[model samples]
Target: MGNYEQFHLIVKWKEQALMIESLLFLFLNIILSDKKQPVSSTPKTYIYDT
Candidate 1:
């Protein structure tokens, strides 16, 4: 019973960690996309011109 409880706790912690990591990754992606937006548009314009 004791070992089972510990395993459950570990699983819960692992889930929380994954959630936080995904959130952080999403945040970084948003920031990066925002930064790249202007540069990315230039390529699209070029593509349209061609």
Candidate 2:
């Protein structure tokens, strides 16, 4: 019973860690995509100006 309890605790910890990592990954992706979008649009504006 004690070993089973320990196993459950470890599993819970691992799940929490995975959740945090995925959230961080998603956050970074959103930030990077936003940064890229503006930079990408800048070229079109420059071409129109020229």
Candidate 3:
């Protein structure tokens, strides 16, 4: 078997690796990204007093 044949076999695996990387990148962003938005504090009396 030549190196290209080995490379061809590896290429299929590389696609799975690329997909995993993309999903991990997306998940990390969703979980760790500091979404730039103003946070509003709700009035304490509304819920706390009840």
What lDDT does candidate 3 reach at residue 6? 93
- TM-score: the better of candidates 1 and 3: 1
* TM-score per model over all chains: 0.69, 0.68, 0.51
Give the Å error, residue 5, model 2: 0.5
lDDT of 1 by residue, 1-50 (tens): 99999999999998888778767766765787788754343432222211
Most accurate candidate by TM-score: 1
Candidate 3: RMSD to truth: 15.2
**True lDDT of residue 50, candidate 2:** 11
Q: How close is candidate 1 to the true structure, as a TM-score?
A: 0.69
- Per candidate, the number of residue pairs that clash is 0, 0, 0
- Residue 37 displacement in candidate 2 (angstroms): 7.0
Of the two candidates 2 and 3, the one with more favorable TM-score, higher being better, is 2
* Candidate 1 local lDDT, residue 25: 62
- Can you write out model 2's per-residue Cα lDDT over 1-50, one digit (the tens) per residue? 99999999999998888778767766765787788754343322222211
lDDT score, candidate 3, position 29: 52
lDDT of 3 by residue, 1-50 (tens): 69999999899888878778767765655554468432345422232221
